[model samples]
Target: MHLDKTPATRGLPRERPVLLAYLRWILLVTLVAVASACALSWALHHPSFESEIRVLVEPAEPRVGAAVAPDMETERQVAISGVVTAAAAQQVGVSATYLQEHASVTVPAASTVLVIQFDDTSAASAQRYAQAIADAYVDYRKGQAATLSAASMPTAATTPNYPVNGAAGLALGLIVGVGSALLRDRSDDRLRGPRDFVERTELPILATVPVRRRRWRRASLLPVLRDPSSTAGEAYRQVSGKVERAARQRRKLTTVTLFTSPSASDGVAHVAANTAIALAQSGHRVVLVECDVRVPRLAGLFDIPSGPGVARALVGRVPLNQALQASEVENLSLLPAGSPGPLGPGELFTFGAVGRLLSAIPADIDHVVVLTPPVLDAAETAVVAEHAHLLVLVAVIGATTRRDLEGAAAELSGGPSSLFGGVLLKAGRGGRAARRSQPLPAEWDDDMGPTAPEDDGVAEETPGTTAIDRRGRA
Candidate 1:
């Protein structure tokens, strides 16, 4: 997965896996903060009030005749008074006011309304006491009234109201929830969408290859190739479309080279081959050229015999026609770097045959794709890049570093403008691309003739005379 650090023709945004993981963490923290704030507020703002109950009494004195004084009012020693103490208060039909002793009461001097409050275990008991205070004033007033020829009567008992504190709890919870969500979204850094690409680099993205999930193996080829509806197939097709678009723009037989930065992997080869197949499938004659002279890949990918390939072809030791073999896929062909050979001077750079081979391809063929070496080893890739009409760099999502991209960019940057298109590969999860519904293109009968059986794996060769693989893997 090691990729060239240079800014790709289409620099991709940061990985999404990192972003999603961050989002989850943010939400969890937010919820926790909200719950804690609510719990704390409820504990502090819990309501407390006093209430009481009491029997009310209305006492009025019967007024003696107004003239009782003239009639020599009999000196009667009839006196009545009531003492209400903590113990005798309730017995005398009065609610105990012990709780009120610890309570506070406030009232404006100019107002008759009073506010009596106390903390008590029982709301009913507090209400009873509140009632008693109201009753006592009523009784005393009634006696005075009667003596003055005007009497008042006691009123029915009423209980005080209780306060609620639920609203405060809700408010605290909301504040914590929203605040946390916002902070989380801002601090996150992993790239999530295409927008990140614009912000990070100057390269124009040629294609954004969706990440495919299906297990990639040699055996999975047909299933993937046949299932255009599948994510992997679709991605291949899209990549192919990109190739075709780039190819059409070029007026002559074009060499579309695929190279990844740093180490080599099958990713580039897969892209190169698939893209070639896709173009051929679309009815344009295509050739998948194995230009990696270091460690050729065409033999393995096409199941052809491996030997001196582009290197041999360059030296004129192997003829162009002898190096190429028809593919099982129609309108598609393979030019594998023929049987393995030793690296030598003038093998790639000094060859006039290289130019001749380019001239040798029939005009009927639409495109010639070269899978080049890693940019770090620019000798070979640069050679191929020089020859290619358009250069396409395939970079893995995370495996490529900024430094690597920069290096690759420096190597391939000055080439023909617009001839280069960067392909960002493996950017998403597997399932998102795997469940596509389109049927795989039907395998051609004559074109998809028997493919070469698998054999020794030397790896994809480099573009020039260098002895390294395209990925620098060797």
Candidate 2:
């Protein structure tokens, strides 16, 4: 039931997350394809060498008075005939069927010339087979007007074409890689990119907290207290400014801003902590209340002693004023959700307890930031709706999905308070599926309503209307 000890930090990831995960998937697939291609190309065929002989056929000159043409086609067929193959096999020390399979013959067009060729796995065997076949064909055609016009010569072994093989590999890799990348992009439920976030929610982002680069800065969640000039620190100050500006527009003397999330691990705790410190740094009297008693984090966050706070005040064990604690930061007070007894979720929020808690704060305080549990998981949101003037949602880019955010926004729509704005964490990488996944589908029933975010960030003016609407804030 305690929130302070829960330690899932969505700000940083252990490996490549979000958009980087998609890129890594593509790279891995492409590399495998290329390596396979290179290996197959080298092992595709064995070294081969070949020798060829040309035989010229001419009509007999003195056999008859009339002119005659030599039958080159018959001469070409004779080169790989059974008798010639049998004799060649004897000379080459191979079977007649093997010699026939390796031998080939062709007649040159418009010429009385026949070409004989042979191939073998080994370079020396290939040349020997070719010469033996050619010699045997010439011997078999001794009565004909055929002559060995060209001598047989062995050629060098052919080499594999590295460039052509490499090009083919590249083409195949790209096709597979691009196709895989597109398929992943579609199924991923996370915010796709910075543009995707704006298009999906349409809510005005109060602040975009960038990821931390240094280890120590990452270790300290309250960057505003440590280094207000840093990028992350400044973003929280911007959040405080937006909250104050929104409150001024409503003309409220004291603003109670509740920062909640759709899930337990959306970096909401860090955001709530730093924003209160940022407001304090700007010289505004701010009281940061940890109302998320189920998983109280403020005590562990500030290293403050955990006793006699919200839980005590809720049961009348201590005066509300006595439960408030002074923080190290000036102009800021911390009220941690201290040790709890048997109590229901609705106690602190009901019977005007919320109003009395607000009234108990010193009159000089400018703002009260309450850190509450996730909207979808907690029932107190409907009750605290009356106390919190401005409601800000904190969503993480890589760890929160579109479906979850929409559901929280819809549930919060039933509230009496105005939907002020939202905060985006880890804005650098998005639009990828990593730690976040789509919520389980709710069963179709009569009481179920449409669960989706409003394209227009305007809550309807009509009461009991269920939609996420930030009317003037858009």
Candidate 3:
């Protein structure tokens, strides 16, 4: 069977990748948070302790016994008292009661210099304390020596010495804290922002969808219809509207294919299935076709048994009617590829049976969304794209690299003859998906005329609904 699939247009958003962008911001903040925490610990604890020294200077005068005066004697004594404290405590080490209590000073007989020492939790604090003591003692001895030299009589003095201690623990803690933050920042591997997309490939992001906390399943498909105000619902409606507008210029309904890159999370298939359901709920007759023969997920998504599906029908053993199963939503259907087996559905992609089965579907369906295999792995997606009216390639924001996207786009560009268009998927508020979409070439828009950037910011808005040519894009 020979099926001629025409090119169809669909609006994809090009707005700021708010979610991916936020992720990058969060990553940067995380790095900063870790740094700040370490700084706090260093500031609050005393890692080093220091002590000070006290010096007493007395002058001696020779007693004069001379010429006949029996005895003349004089004596002098001086006493000094003070306490030692760490110098520039805030700059090098934190102050603590324990460090101050343990500091002591020792003075020896006829010693001009008094030695003081301190114990600090950290080595750096200890070093700093030692340096401060040395500087202070040097100054103290100079003043004492000068005074004693000028005195002609001998004197005795007693002084209470204060001990100095160094800050050691505080310095070590600071280093450890900063180092830990740096290491954590280095090891982080989560997707950061849109810049990551270009790092891997040069492909343009066509559309970006935000992240949703809710699980996506075909059974409960009322959110898009019930709550148009919610972000998820709005996204669903917005995507559906964009698809409709893109196809408005074409005579036949568009066949949009969704495919993740090889490394994409399992979220891509979920996006495609739910997106199709949302379109069907909004009055379009949508059929979700399972094109991922290698790792089929449609049956599991809908909770259906994989029997007489695309694989069976393609081989001509089952009719399309038996293989297609109606979903919970009205006017929506699922064409599963069936369960995993040795039949090698991936092999069936090259055979002509797959084409005939797809073509056999009725033309009344408003849209057909296919969850194809990863572009980098299976040829089935490219094979399926051959018979599709338009290829809507799905890409997760940060997961798919720019190089991979570029390669995918290049692979799809078998010329205008090959039905292909780009659709960026899994783009959330802040993530790799949040960047503005790359501009389409002039030729891609020549036939469609001016289309507006959809509310999401990718597809340009056409002046009026009638502005669409309804014959497919040029």
Candidate 4:
């Protein structure tokens, strides 16, 4: 089961659920922005009335063959001058600056027409201001007939214009939200769905353990031991069944399975503990080995003392039987990682201590489950993986990265260990339902095999209990 081909050829398809997760954050940000914009617009907004006045302008004497237009720019400037503005202000009982700020004058291109626009808080005030400006401009042009003349009295409009549009604001918010969601999806590197693991590694997933929400204050860590009928317990049982079937197919006198991950905190230790329990529940003499000397968790998990375990046995300070401790579970034994000697964890494994420790296990044990440190973080995992009969990779659903899994796979595939498959842990509800319901293998019976004879040889009466051939088929 060693794959020499690179995993780089495998590519993960983008999942809709991951995109929806990204969209949720994007929409949240968009809503906040839109609300703030709307609030500021309301707080700073001032409603005003607008009025327009149209005036017809013409030269006092019509020039039939004029080289250029009758200087409309000069007439436009004269309409908004201080003299006309002062007169408008006096008529309207307002300051000259106020009249100038509120009114504007424009002349239409290639035409003898001037338009005056004014804005005020009151509709009547806006109309009055526009009319006053037009009248003042007409009187000022009375003496300058050669330049321009007011052809008609100004006519003011009563309607007002509003500037805000709700539809436009909504459109802007949606555009921003979608843009942000795309950016977030591009930047996220963690695996978000089962497809990520399947496509990236091209490895068959053995089981998907659902995310266990901490419902109570003191929840037990071993779900299979505490509640075998729970979702988590069922998942562990499924994994254990697969491991047992694989081991049976190997047909080796001793079956050693190593569980490790790309990094720490991926819950490989927990999976190893529960899988051992599940195996022992089915009437197998299972031995759970804690080889992660640097940071051991099985000792604390089972509430057992940590001394005289793997570390002591490896260094020849303690015999194998002295290190083997009994757990509360029936037919299951525990070997916790003892205190790191003066050589430290790194130096202890270099002397071929791990292999010797594993080989020294009692011949009567059915399965030896070893929980090792993360492959990427610790060197001991590579050493242990070399001796184990099978390797099971553990990856957290949302926490593990594609690069990490690929790197771990490449490292193990290059080594001597045979990769069984992978287990995706902490998978949410979707993963649980996505898993195909598989019936337990018929060979996994309560009386799978007879006890080994006293001479450390497999009993001859139980040929059916012997390991199945390497194909894993009965």
Q: State model 4's lDDT.
A: 0.69
Worst 10 residues of 1 by lDDT: 71-80
Query: Candidate 2's residue-wise lDDT over 372-430, tens digit each?
Result: 88887888765665567778887876667778888877776556676666787763322
lDDT of 2 at 278: 82
Q: Kindly provide the TM-score of model 4 when superposed on the true structure, using C-alpha atoms.
A: 0.73
User: Which is better, 3 or 4, measured by TM-score?
Assistant: 4
Assess every candidate by TM-score: 0.51, 0.76, 0.54, 0.73
Stretches of candidate 3 exceeding 4 Å from the true structure? 1-53, 59-191, 194-207, 212-229, 253-256, 398-407, 414-474
Error of 2 at 378 (Å): 2.7
Better of 1 and 4 by TM-score: 4
In candidate 1, position 49 carries an lDDT of: 49
Q: Write the per-residue lDDT of candidate 4 for residues 1-474, one digit (tens) a residue.
A: 442223432344445653466666667766766666666665665656677777666565546765444577777777788998999899989998888888877877777777877877777788788888888887877743222322222343222211233444556667777787777667766665556776766666777777543232113357799977888788899989988887776676557789999976777777899999999999889999988877777776776777667776767667778889999999999998776656566766653566566656767788889998889999888987877777889987666777888888888877766777788875434324222212222221111211221121111111112121221211
Q: Which stretches of candidate 4 lie over 4 Å from their true place?
A: 1-14, 17-19, 39-47, 51-84, 104-116, 121-128, 134-176, 213-220, 427-474
Once fitted onto the true fold, the runs of candidate 1 whose alpha carbons sit more than 4 angstroms away are 1-201, 211-214, 219-224, 253-263, 344-353, 427-429, 433-474
Candidate 4, residue 280: Cα displacement in angstroms equals: 1.2
- On TM-score, the candidate that comes out on top is 2
Over 1-474, each residue of candidate 3 has an lDDT whose tens digit, in order, gives 112332322232333433343455445555555555555545665444343333333333337744331111111111111212333233335453433444445555445434445555544445455444444433443543222111111121111111111123334444554555556445534333334443333333334455532443343233464455655566556656666765664545444444445443434565676678678877888888887656566666666666556666655556778879987779898988764334564655653655566566776767877777776667776676665555555655545555556676666656342333344444433322234322222221132122221122111111212111131323
How far in Å is the alpha carbon of 387 misplaced in model 2? 2.2
Backbone clashes in each candidate structure, one number apiece?
Answer: 47, 9, 67, 0
